[model samples]
Target chain A: MSAAMTQASSQAMSHAATDKRCDVSVKDVEISFGRHVVLEKLSLDIAQSEFIVLLGPSGCGKSTLLNAISGLLDVNAGQIWIGGRNVTWEEPKDRGIAMVFQSYALYPRMSVRENMSFGLRVAGMPANEIQKRVADAATMLKITELLDRKPSQLSGGQRQRVAIGRALVRDAGVYLFDEPLSNLDAQLRAELRVEIKRLHQRLRATMIYVTHDQIEALTLADRIAVMKDRVIQQLDTPQKIYREPVNRFVASFVGSPAMNFMPGRVERGATGATFSLGDLSIPIQGYPFKSPGLTGAAVLGIRPEHVLSGAEAGPNAFNAQVEMAEPMGADTLVWCRTPSGASFSVRVDSGPSIAPGDTLPVSFPVGTLSLFEEGPDGRRL
Target chain B: MLAIRPRLASRLAAWVALSPALAVLVVVYIGCTTWTIWISMTASRMLPSSNFVGLRQYEALFANERWTVSVSNLVIFGTMFMIASLALGFLLAVAIDQRVRAENLLRSIFLYPFSMSFVVTGLVWQWVLNPTFGIERIGKNLGFADFKFDWIVRQDMVIYCLVFAAVWHAAGLVMAIMLAGLRGIDEDIWKAARVDGLPTWRVYVSIVVPMMGASFATASVLMATSVVRLYDLSVAMTNGGPGIASEVPAKFVMDHLFERQNIGLATAAATSMLITVAAVVGPFLYWQSRRRAAAGAH
Candidate 1:
C-alpha cells in the first residue's frame, strides 16, 4: 500500500468510536483471514432506533464489518460496545442483536410457528409466551394463515416477511440485515423495501442493513456508509454522500449510471476559476472554493442531471451533437459527445434524433462540477 | 387439426421413454409373483403340475420345524440390525459434520464397507467374532485369555452375531446418505441456532436431525429392503448353525427351493413374504401421500 493510502486508512480508523446512542460501536476494527486482510481499521457507530445502511460493492468489507459487530468474526484489532457495555468478546446471542439472513434460513420440517419460535423454544420460553410471540409476529407479517404452513409452502415474498418476523420476535435492540432483499425479484424487492422502511418507523428500532445497491441505501438509510477497499470511504446522510462526496470513489459509487467525468486543467482567471476541457471552459462562478491548489492537473466531475439539455436553460451553454437518446416517457436521457472526444449526458423532456457517431459540444455549468487532484493521490481538493 | 394441451407432448414422450422399463417391471415382477402364487397352490416337488391342492403347502410350511425357526430368526435379526445400523450411522454422520479435520478420510473409512461384497464383509466379521480364532486370540496375545465373544456358538445368542455383522455391513451406506443430507443443509441454520442461544447438542436434536427427513427416509427404505432380503451375510457368518439360528427369509426360501426339493413350500413362503411387505408398505405409502398433500395445501 502507498503511504497516502495507509494514511487514509489510519485516519478512517481513528474515528472508531463515538458516544453510544445505540447499543453498538466498533473502534478501529481490523480483521484478517490467513494472509488476506478483509477489513482494516473499520469504525462505525450505530445509534438506537437508527437505520444505518452500509452500501458498497462486493468484497468491500461491509458484510465483514457487520460480522465483526455481531460477534460472528473476531477482529485482530479494535473494540466493540453494545448496549452501553463493551462487548468485544461477547458471543452473538449475548450482544442483543438479531440478524435476518439474505436467504430466509427457515427450518423446513418446522411449521411457520415453530420456525419463528424455535429460538424462544430453545431458550425454554413458556409455551404460552412462545405461542403469543409467534401469533403476534405472524399477525404483524400478515402471515396468520401461514403459521401452520411450512416455509416451502409460502411464496418468496411471504418467506422474506417471515424471516424479518423471525428477527422482530427477538425484540433485539439492533437488527442486522445482510442484503436481505437481494434474492427477491425487483418488484417484490421494492414492495418489501417500503415495508421494511415502514416497519422501522413503526417499531422505532435500530437496524444495520447492508447492500451493494445505492438506491436501497438512498431510500432506506437514515445514514449511509459507503465502503471501498476494506475501509469506509465516506459516511454521511444519503444526500450529503451524493452531493458532496469526499473522494472520487464515493462520488461515482452512489448515483445511478454514475457521475460523468472529464480530465481537464484548472485555470485561474480574473473573475473566478474554471475547469478547461477541449475548447470549452466552464467557469466556477459561485461556491467559494479556492482552485489555485488544483492547478492544471485535476479532474472535472459533474452529475449528468446538472447539464441542461432543454431549450430554455441557464447561462453556461455549448452546442453539441447528440449521440443517442433513451426515452422513459417522462424523461429522456441524451448522450452527447464533444468534438474533442469528451462525453457527457443530460436528461431532458425528450430525446434527440442523432445517431451514435454524431458530434456535439455540451456545456459544463458553473459551480456544478467538482475538481479533484490528478495523478498518484487523486483525492478531492 | 386436432388441438392438444400444452403439456401433452412432454407427457406422451415421458410415457414413451418409460415403456421398456414399465414392460420389464410388469412382466418380471408382477409375472413372477403371479407364477409364484400359482406354484404355491399346486402339489409340486421340483416341477410344476396342473393339479391344484389349496393351502396344503402353507399348512405344511407352518408345521415344518426349520421353517418356524427361520421365521423367528428373520424377525429378530431384521429388527435388531436395522435399529443398530440407523443409530450408529446417524451418530457417525453427526460426528463428521462438526467441521472435523480429515473429513474425507473419515468419510472414506466409513463408506469403504459399502463398496465391499457381503461375502467379504461376512467373512471378516465372522473371523472377528470367532471365539477361538480372532477376538479371543487377540485378547490372549494381550494376556487376557478369557475374553469370550462367542455369540456365534449359542443357539439363543447367534442372531445377535448376525445382527452385529449386518449392522457393520449396512451402517456405512447409511452414514454416506446422511452426510450428503447434512452437507446439503443451509449453513445459516447453524448460525440461526447459535444466535438463538442453542447449545450444540440441542441444535442437532431440535433442528439438524429433524430437518434431515428426506435423508432418513432414503436410509430407512434402503434398510427395510435389505432386512427383507437378508441372506449372504447370515450364511457366511453363522451358516444357520447353533441349531437353525440366524436364518433369514431369503435363506429360508432358497433352502426350500433348491436344497430340500420343496418348491411348493418355497413358493408359499415367497407369497407370504410378499403379503407381509404389502401389508407394511401399503399404509406407509398412503400416509406419506396424505402428509405430502396436507403439507402442500398449506
Candidate 2:
C-alpha cells in the first residue's frame, strides 16, 4: 500500500512539473504570404503564467508571430503546442486561446455585454452561464458600468477594457495581444499598461503581447523577445536585454535617445584589451565579454546615461565641445563631438546650465560599454 | 465691426453661391409637384381642364381592375426584387471577398448589368426569356422535348419573370454597394471574430451586417425607388402582357395618359403614388435628420 502511495505521489509530482512547464510552444514555425516570408523557422516557448512581449519595429514579424500562435495565420511548416496539446491543425476557436487586437476590434453595433458574451454564445454555452462569465469578466475589468453602451459610446480606454474583458471571458489557456495599446494616447496607454500588468499579476495567465513600443515591453513583460528580420535576436528579461543586448540592433532598438555607436577597434596587449578610436584608447579591464580574446575592428556602444558628468570624472576624462543641448524636463541631453570626431550624447540633470560649443569633461566607464564586431552581421564581441 | 462686415459679406456670397440649386429645386421639383397635385383634382380627360372634381377620379381609379392588379403586382415585385437582390448581392460580395484571383475582372463582370440602362436590360432579357426561341428552344435542341420555361407568357408567373430580370440588373449594384461596405471594414475585425470562435455566417449576420447599416440602407433605398418607378422594365419585358397580369403602377399611369386618353385617372394614380411615397419617406427623413442633429449635439 505504501509503495502504491509513493507511485501515485510520483505521478502527481510529474503532472505538477508538466503544469509548470511551457504552456505554449511554437516549434520551427515558418509563415509566408505568397512570395514574402514573414517568419522563418521562428520558435518560442512561453512558460505557464509568463508574460512575454514580442518587441520589434514595424514589419518585423512580431505581430505575425502572435497571429501564428493564436492560430489566426497558417504556418508553412511547424508545430504549435498549447497546454500539452498540439494545436497546429486546430482552428483558432479550438486552440484554447483568445486575442486582443490593436484597434480593439469591438463590434461597434453591439453593447459591451453582447460583445463580451458573443464568443460564449457562439460556442453554444448556456444563457445563464454566458451571463455569469460576462459579468465576472466585466467586474474584473471594472467595465460593468459600461456594459449597456455600444463601443462608439465608450472612451478609447473603456473600449479596450471591454476588449480585454472579451478575451478574459474565454477562460483560455493563453491570451494574445497584438499591439492592443498602440491606438491609445500616451496617458491612456500608460494607464492601461499598468492595468494590464495588474491583470497579469492577478490572473497569472500565459500572455504573449506584441508591440513596437519598447517602453510597453519593458514595463509589462516578464521576458522580452526582441525580433528583427523575422527572427528573435534575443529572448531574456528586460533588464538583461537592456544591459546586455545580444547585438548592435537590439541595443539600438530598445533604448530611447538610443545608444551612441562610435567606430573603433579592439587591441589586446599586456595590460588588457583596449578599445581604440582615432587617438582615444580606453582600457576594457572590467568589461564583460561573451567570448574571450576579443580583438577586432569593432564598434563601441555607450548609452547616454552611462557617460559620467561633473566631478565623477577620473583620470580617463576627456573634453568634448557641446554641439546641441536639448532640455527634456528631467534631464538635459548634451550632444557633443569627442576629440576623435565621434558624436557622443550625455544625459545630465536639469540643474546644469550648458550651451552649444561649451566643452565639458566627460568619462566613458568601462563597465557599461557594448562592443560589436564591425561586419554585416554586427554580432557582439 | 470689421469682423462682422466680412462675415456679413461672406453670408451674402453664400446665398449667391446657393442660388442656382435653390432655383432648380423650386422650379423643377416643388413647382412641378405642386402643378401635378393641382391637375389631379381636375376633371381633365384629353387635356387638363380647370373643372374641379372632388376625389371622383380617385374613386374611379380604385374601382378599375387593371389599376388594382397593377398595385398588387408592384407589392409582389417590390418585395421579391428587394429581398432577392439584397440576399444575392450580399452572398456575391462575401464570395468575392474570399481573396479570389482575378478579382477586378470578376467585379466588372458582376457590375456590368448595372452599368446598362434598365430599358436595355429589359429588352435583352425579353429576347433571352422568349419561350419559343430562347431557353425552351435550346432545351428542345438538347433533346428535352417536354421542357417548358414559358413563365414569360403565363399570367400568374409573368410578374415573376419581370422580377427575375429586375433582380439580374439591380443585384449587381447592390453587390457593388455591399462590397464597398465589406472592404471598408477593418481587417482586424475579422481576426477578432475568428479568435472569438464566431462562424463566418454569424459574423455577417450579427456583427458585419449590423455594422453595414448605411450600405444596406443605400441599396434598399435605391431598390425601393426603382420598384416604385417600375415602368420601362414592364413595358420592354412583358408589356402588361398575358391580359394585364404584369402591369405596374407607373405603366398604368402612362397608358391611361396617352393610349387610353384618360388624363383624370392617370393624374389620380400619379398623385396616389406621390402621396404614398411621401407618407413612407417623410417620417423616415425626419427621423434621420433628428438622429443626425442629436449625434452632432453629442
Candidate 3:
C-alpha cells in the first residue's frame, strides 16, 4: 500500500510539468444580453503562464468578460485567439479550456473520482488514461481519500477542491475561474487563495480569474485588469494599478479605506502650477502631469496611508482636526478635516493615541498625490 | 417534583391533542379492516350471517372468470399506465426546462388536466375515442374513407383505451413534480456539463435523472396508489363493458358488494387487494426509510 501510494504521488507530481501552457487574447469582444450591453469593445492580451485577474464590482462586466473568454457566453463581434488559434466560434470544450464555477458545481450524484474523469470519459479517452489522470488530479488536490465520496458528503472547501480537481483533470491549455472563492467562508477563502497561488506557481499555466474582491486580485494576479461600466480602466501590474490608477473609478474601486479626493483648482504661475485649496496653495512643481501646461479645476487624490501626521508632518504641513478614529488592529484610520474644510482620512500607527477633536498637522507628499480633472471622467492629470 | 408535575400535565395535553386522530385510526381504519377480514371468512349473503367457511369464498373468487379477467386486466393496465405516464411526464418536464418561451403559461396548460376530476377526464376521453364521432369519424370526414379507430368497442384493445385516458389524466401531475425537481438543480451544473463536453441527453440520463430520486419516488408512489384505486374511470368510460374486458379488481369488489349481493366473495377480493398493496408498499416504505437514514448519516 505504501509503495503504491508513493508511486501515485510521484506520478501526480510529475504531471503538470509536461502539460502545455497557452496564451489567450481577446480582441475587441462585444457581448450583450438583448439591448443591455455587458461588455463593449473589450480587448485584452494575456501572456502564457501569466495569472490575470479581472477585478471590478458587481455588474461591471468582469464576470461577463471571463465568460466570453471561456466560451460560456458568445460574443457579438470580434474574435478570441487562444495559443494563436481563432476559437471565437468554437464550443467551450473545443476551445481547449477548463473552468471552475463559484458554486462548486460538481455532479451531485457522482463520486469525486467520477466527477474529475467525466470530461475525459465523454471525450472517449481510454479508461486507463482517464483513471490515471483522475488519480493524479485527486492526489495533487489531496483528495485521494475523498475520491469515493459524493459532493454532498463534503464540506464547502472540500467540494471546491474537488471542483478544481475536476477542472485540473481536463489538462487543457488555459483555465478560467469565475469567482470560485466567493461561496466560501472568509477563513477558507484565505486558505484556498494561497493554495491557488501556489498551484499557479507550480503549474505555470495561463489562468484568467474573475473576482470582485481586491485582495484576491492583488495577491494572485500577475497582471490586474480593473474594469468598470463595460470598459477596462487599466491593465497593469498590481503595484502600478494600485499606485497609478487611470481614473477616479479605478482608484475608488480598488484598495480598502479607498483613496480620498479633494476638489480644488490648479492655477498656472511663473514658478509652476499650484493646486489651491481655499487659501492654501501647494506647489505641483515636480509632479508628473499628463500635459505640462495643463491648469484647470482638478481633484487631488491621496491614499490614507500616504498622509503624514505628527512628527512626519513637518513645517510645510497643513493643519487639520481629527474627526473620528477607526481602530483596525494593525493601524488606526483617523478621519480629519483640513483648515480648508475638506474631509479626508489618514492612516496612523495604532500606538499613537489619536482622538476626536484633536488638532494635528497633516501633510500630503508631492510624489504620492494624484491629480485628476475635476469633472465626471476624472482622467489623471 | 415541580418539573414532574409539569411534564405529566404536558403529557395529558398531548394525549388530548392526539385523541381525535387516534380515535379515527382505531374506529375508521383498523376497525373496518378487521371487520372486513372477519366477514371474508364467514358466509354472509344478502344479510349478515355468521357461519364459518374456510377459504371457500377465495377459492370461488379465483375460479370465477370475471374476477380472473378483472385481475389480469388490472395488471396490464397498471403496467402500461405507470410506464407511459412516467416517461411522457419526464419528457414534458425536460422540454419545459429548456428555458422555453412563456414557461409559466405552458406549465399551467400542461398541468391543467390534473386539476380536473378523473370522471371528467374519462367522459372527455370516452367521447374522443367513440369510433362514430371521434378520430375515426373525423378521419373519414376529412377524406380517409377506410379509417377504423374503434379500440373502446373491442375486448382485447379496450384496456389500452383505459390506459390512454388514465395516462392523460395522471401524466400532468408527474410532470409538475419532475419540473420542480428540474428547477431545483443548480444552473452552474449545466454550464459545467457543457464545459465537460457531455451531450445534453447523456447528462440528463446519467447525472440529472439520478439526482432526481426524490421526485421519481413521489411520482411513482402517487401513481401506484391511483392504480390501486382505479374504479371510477372504468365505470365512467367503459362500465367494464364490451364483454367485461376492461374490468378491474376494485370494480369487481364494488359490483359483488352492491349489485350482486355476494358479500363474502366481495370481502375476499377486497382482502386480496389489500394484501397485494401491502406486499408492494411495505418494502417500498422500508427502502425509503433506509435511504433517509443513510442520507442522515452523511
Give the per-residue lDDT of model 2 (tens digit) for A1-381. Answer: 334323433432223222333399999999999999888888888889899999998999998888888888889999999888998989998887889999999999999999998887877776766787778778878998999999999999999999999998776668899999999999999999999998887777788999999999999999999998898999999999998888989999998889988988888888888888889878888677877876778988889999987777688888888999999999999999988899989999989699998889888898888888785458777
Best by TM-score: 2
Ranking by DockQ: 2, 3, 1
Per-model fnat list:
0.62, 0.88, 0.81
Compute the interface RMSD for candidate 1: 1.1
Clash pairs (backbone) in predicted model 1:
A22-A48, A23-A82, A23-A83, A320-A360, A320-A361, A321-A359, A321-A360
The lDDT-based order of candidates, best leading, equals 3, 2, 1
Q: How displaced is residue A289 in candidate 3, in Å? A: 1.6
Indicate the TM-score of model 2: 0.93
TM-score values for chain B across all models: 0.91, 0.93, 0.97
Per-prediction DockQ scores? 0.61, 0.86, 0.76
- For candidate 1, write residues A1-381 as lDDT tens digits: 234323332321212111223556888888999999998777788777788999999999999888888887888999998878888888888887888888888777788888888887777666765676677667767888888888887888899898888887766668889899999999999999999998787766688999999999999999999998888888899988888777788888888767877788877788677777787777865644554434576777778777765454455666776778777677776788765678778766654554566544456666566766675326776
Evaluation by lDDT, superior candidate among 2 and 3: 3
Candidates in order, TM-scores: namely 0.89, 0.93, 0.91
C-alpha RMSD values across all candidates: 7.5, 4.5, 4.3
Grade the docking of candidate 1: medium
- Interface RMSD after interface superposition, each candidate: 1.1, 0.7, 0.7
Native-to-model Cα distance after best TM-score fit, residue A48 in candidate 2, in Å: 1.9
